[model samples]
Target: MASRLKKKCCTLYEAALEVVTSRYSFYKHDLEMLPDSVLFDVIYEVYEKGGIQPLREAFSRVDIVARLLKITDKRFCLIRSFQGALTSMFWEEVPRGTEEAVLQSQFLVEFGGGVPNSLAKGYENLCADLEDTQVQVDRLVETGLRLGGFLSDAGWFAESERILLACQEIFKWARKEGRIWLQILECCQKLLHVQSSYCHFEEADVTYNASVTTVVGLQGDFVTANLAVLYKEFSALHFNRSEYSLAHYWAVESLRAITTELPPCVIIEVFRQASKACVVKREFKRAALLAREVLCLANEVFDVNDPRYADALMDYGFFLINHDRVRQSVSIYELALDIRLAMFGPMNLHVAIAHEDLAYALYVYEYSSGRFIRAREHADKALFIMEKLLPRNHLLLASVRRVKALILEEIALDNMVHDAGTHILLQNAEELHKSALDLALRTFGERNVQTAKHFGNLGRLYQSMSRFQEAEAMHLKAIAIKENLLGSTDYEVGLSIGHLASLYNYHMKKYRKAEELYHRSLDISLKLFGESYSGLEYDYRGLIHVYHKLGDIEKVAQYTYVLNNWKIQRQLSLIQEDDPLDSVGSPLPIADVAALFFEDDLD
Candidate 1:
């Protein structure tokens, strides 16, 4: 290795010798022979003993070389210039890129492995001055953010936590050093994101409190805006934990923090989150209103063709469905589905989801219109895409299958004749409902709301099939699960109760039992959706039928009056001047009207 280095240095020396000799014709021989002179041997010995620095020092000994050669000072100066050039050539060839690589490697080691400590304390002990302290702080902040993000993306949460913790400490130092509040806020946001995402809720709470303190301490232009951001993120954290009440509280706080200067998209996002919390908390009216705001904002900010606008439209459609505006929601769902299909193409997941949304709205709308064809088509499309793309028991697939089953059941019910095609459709519907039930059991177990709904679906299907005993058992199971999971007065429990009452009144001739269940369901519906709720009609009719069975003409006439008033109010409520889909005073189809008059109730 020594000999090879020597040979390489000699080659470099000869190359410099050629350039120098060509540049200066005079003293060329003396300069060329200088390599074989005593000075050359002395310089080589210095290089061999102490390396490049010593070799460079030895090369700078121009006076000693001049004295030995007896050359003029002017010629010695020229010789010194050549010596410097040769030193630079060797210095340039030494590969200093390795040094930078080593520095980076060391920084990562300290970043990932170093103990969590105050950056101020570390800098005070190690840094020579404030300028160096500042430089260190800046480097740590910049690199920590970049590397921490990369580690997070790689799922190296532990290492990412270490780096982000170090960044937080540096941020603490920056705050004490009277750094800008915005900078500290930025660091706090990053730290909170890491903690909340990785289930570090305890640590995240501390960081959130600290961030709130920092924001409160500031008196700046973006104070409300920054608070809005913090509140929005904290709401999401609570949402991730399924703490809907707290999520709604923080979401409301975020909404309050919104300023006129805030971007439309940010406002829309906050409204969307708040609306989600509202939906989960069963605040349907508020959820629908906020969802409309999101849609309006998105429409204002984005092009109609934009996927974001489509997303907003889809969300609004969902809220509309929950708000009991199924007719309006059908149109909204159709628009969103068209946008998604046009932008994402047929096989895309968003397109499939859009189809599923439209399918759901259409399925519900078909109850009023008795139009199952379009609903079945959309349900089939969604089912086809989901079966091709998702796992067999995927949660989304289960939902789509449930919708398809309902659409098929509606079509089968429309066909009154017990022909081969009708029997086949009913069988297919039963299979789909069972398949959905199995998927729900596999994914969410028996106690879940989804599982309860599947039971209720089977109950309705059995009622349609004239399997009275099996229908009663399924309805009982559904009511029990829903009452246990969502409490007795929930909307879902009310629907199940209403269905069970229908089974009793229509098939079992248990008028007194049917009357009790119908009253209980009516109480729930009235409590949740008020007297104007269209669903109340089913329960009222069930009670009227029970009275008629008992030969109580007065009771039947009373309920008939109530049902007529309910229909009148519903028709009035359905009128909306701006929405053509509302179609004021439009009569429900014979199928739904028949349902109102002692038919099977599948609310």
Candidate 2:
């Protein structure tokens, strides 16, 4: 009955709503003074909420009384109104009054069946639909490009594509709407997913495959933006794939083509996405440079005081620390931290993150530069900020504790350098290593990659103090974990192997093992970067050193000869090399000829 396209019941319901609205409140229970329309409207509101039985019975009785007396057409639903209301509730899954509810109803429909079909084949149809939609939308874009611009006023209104997407989404929502759904969904889906779907008059007849009538009514600023969005999604997902460089290039083009003026924050969002893609590839230098450029653009286009600019500055600081440029990164981070403090006060999560990050940076630089006292100060600040923001056993606070212990050990190593010949430093290093091991094991779990990092750092520290046996154990555990988590061919795994090989070559006098590890590390490093040439430089030097330790004069000479050839080849490569900082636009220097020491000395 609800699905029946009858106009009288809907009209009568609206009339009833009018009579009772001013005088009747749904919550009221004053039955004796209630108006006649109150009964009809009460049933109507109940029907809207899907409250079955009570409203249905009341309306059915009213219908019978009116029918027996032949009360007439205008108020006929007065008796069967409740039944009609119930029927209208979910008929054909037509959209509710708003978009959100429509999406919710889709979920409700899906929940009608329990369990997934439990096989890949069950999902094939769903995937195909999405792909089919993608194809049609692609065609829509080419048509729009050919036509040149939008066609009408409804098309011009803000978010016209949303209206179009709504048509498809609403239709796709049903198991029964089929053809009507396809036509409507395709119409909107084309505007967003395909550009060439918009018909062009000039291309009409034998001149074109489609006519101007194809556009329907696509015009105005909003329509232009809708079309531009299709182009943006296509470039982001297809042409660029993973390269941040290509993605940023297209984002700029598509953003400019849109007729509407996007907010500065939205523009900064594009920069954020591109920078993240760079970071995902571990291209820290490029990411930091892009983020810095974005920072300048954000502040210039928006406000110097914009929180987003400060946030961009903070992101650059993170990439710097990851790339080992902590010394130069400190000032930018401090600036961001100060800005967040001013904007959100001391306890904000943003301020806390900045404090923690700056502390981590200061810790790395302090120990490297022999300033443990200043490093400890920053560590304390980090601890305070983290305590306010996280639980007691949070991994970050525990990590900071390990950093403090490392700082103390570094101070011990400095004092022992003049007096005890590294014996005291070695002892302090053991205790600090234990602290790192304990904290990392408890905070990140024993098998975590981060736990392995702490082990490796401790191993290197011990190797520095000439504690060969202990360093060997730590490095072995680190290698095993790293090899399992990151493939053996990864640069980090190679670097760890090289560190172990160096200890055996220089301090332990284990020449055979040193030669074996060096070969292993070299093979992996060469696999990853041999073609790039720069990567091969470090690994080749390691191999040369290994050959020297084994007293293989012929092998050493052979490796050395290859290294020289590589240097010459590097000079000739057509890569857009960031000319060395020392070069400063001058002709490249010849290292072999200009060297102060003889090549034989290196041998």
Candidate 3:
């Protein structure tokens, strides 16, 4: 009976191996269909074969391996087989048993089937048994790190944090060992990144402080590299809070800490953050220089079509657009669009963003029929993709809707000028603007800057339709919000003032009111952007026209002289480039002005 049983086991093992190693097209399905006893025999046979290449290939099919683990009665042997496959696949330099145990625990946690409780209990027992062994503790820490990273990337933030914190506790016992200490520091850094990303600022700060303390305690010349990482993380934290100056300072500190031996990606990130900070600070020349460096470094380290390269291109494009280099921005945006389209296909959210950005750049660059049509096409594509992928109240959806409304408003203006389809175009533009405003208010709240801009946009649309009372109300609401959020002296407040001033001067014939508002705008603009900003021209022209209408010849002459001097300064200072607005066009979108003065970096 014993001889018969041994022969039957051998026969079953051989049959299992034949099913796994056969080149039949449906082998995975067949493997899943095998009975538990035969599957157990296959697991033992595969392990005893001493070569795990076939098992590694099988494990790569995660679903098949998962089902096999689910059905197998010899759970420990099956898990060891899976781990051996992973070791062979990754060429991991660890003991087979320790690695197997770690892999099994992680698998159970991630897959969360009937085995999780058993796996949890087993891990607890193993930890208790190895409480005094430094080697086993170190292995456990590494396992936790890998598992934590996987969970973090999967967006299981709380789970990842729990695992990492548990690992930190285990690591405390082995902290005196340099290798273990470094691993612990890495776990802390990962936890901090996860916390910061989820807006758990208080927790992130605690992690940051703890990481700083750890780095300070470590005794090594190699600590500078670690310091660089800490500084970069702090920079990201400040950047998230819109503290651009602090972000830039920390980014610069990070750069200073980096030695030549550090990877180029680290230096690239520092430059990228610094460039974005400079853009927000309105330090255009410095921002452009840093952006160019980012492009160069990214090109050297990544393919031109790589997603990182595409992001750098988009950032540079936005910087150029902010500085009024619209034509240059169009080409850069096109390159980014091509890369994103190729990488993610046309319907992806990234592709939608690229399309929307390109559309906005083109719309700002020119408002001819051709440009408007093309811009509308891009905007429509973006709206379609966003509507498909995002919730109704997503801020990104509102942004795209605002872009579409701007395009329709411009088209309405065009039709009005030509006396063609005026009523329908105006009606469409008004409704779209209202829809965008409602969406913005819902997503960003009434006092939010974006919602304020939406009100200003609708104000401009109302003015175009000869609804002066509604326009005035909208403008006043926008101004109030701007003043409340940004204070009265901010450039954004200046923009609101200028918009209201234009309404008074052109539509309401309130010359004195227009003159007052224009002067206020001029004062704010000069204080915020200096005298040479191109936007100042709008205030100067408004003031001149208002004074002229009121027959205030003296003030008109004074403003004319100021305007002439400004024109001369502009001529001397302006770099020769394609001016998208050579002729007067419709009122600029509040979104465009907002982009210029308060651009937010999209990560």
Q: Pick the candidate with the highest lDDT.
A: 3
lDDT of each: 0.66, 0.50, 0.67
Q: Compared to the true structure, candidate 2 yields what TM-score?
A: 0.43
lDDT of 3 by residue, 252-293 (tens): 676567666767666666667667766766666567656777
For each candidate, give its TM-score against the true structure.
0.58, 0.43, 0.61
Q: Give me the runs in candidate 2 sitting further than 4 Å from their true place.
A: 1-277, 283-293, 301-307, 324-327, 341-356, 359-373, 387-389, 417-447, 462-467, 516-548, 552-603
Which of the two candidates, 1 or 3, achieves a greater TM-score against the reference?
3
Question: What's the distance in Å from true for residue 281, model 1?
Answer: 3.2
RMSD of candidate 1 to the true fold?
A: 22.1
Candidate ordering by lDDT (highest first): 3, 1, 2
| Candidate 1 residue-wise lDDT, 1-603, digit = tens | 888877654567567654543433343334435543534444433333334434333333323332333332223232223222222223354466655423322432333112112222342333233243667666556656654543343233444566667666666546454544665776676677667655566787888888889887887675566677778777877765445568889887887777767767667767777777677667776675567667656766777776667777777777777767788888888888887655544544566778888988888877866788888888888887666544456556777889998888888888768678877888998999999899778755787777889999999999988899999999999999887866788788889999999999999999899999999999988877777787888888889889999999999999999999999888877884147223223333323322332223312
Model 3 C-alpha RMSD vs. true structure (Å) is 14.5
Q: Highest TM-score: give the candidate number.
A: 3
* Cα lDDT over the full model 3: 0.67
Give the per-residue lDDT of model 2 (tens digit) for 363-462.
6666546766766676556555555444455444555556655665677666665657456655665675566577567744656566776788788788
Kindly provide the TM-score of model 3 when superposed on the true structure, using C-alpha atoms.
0.61
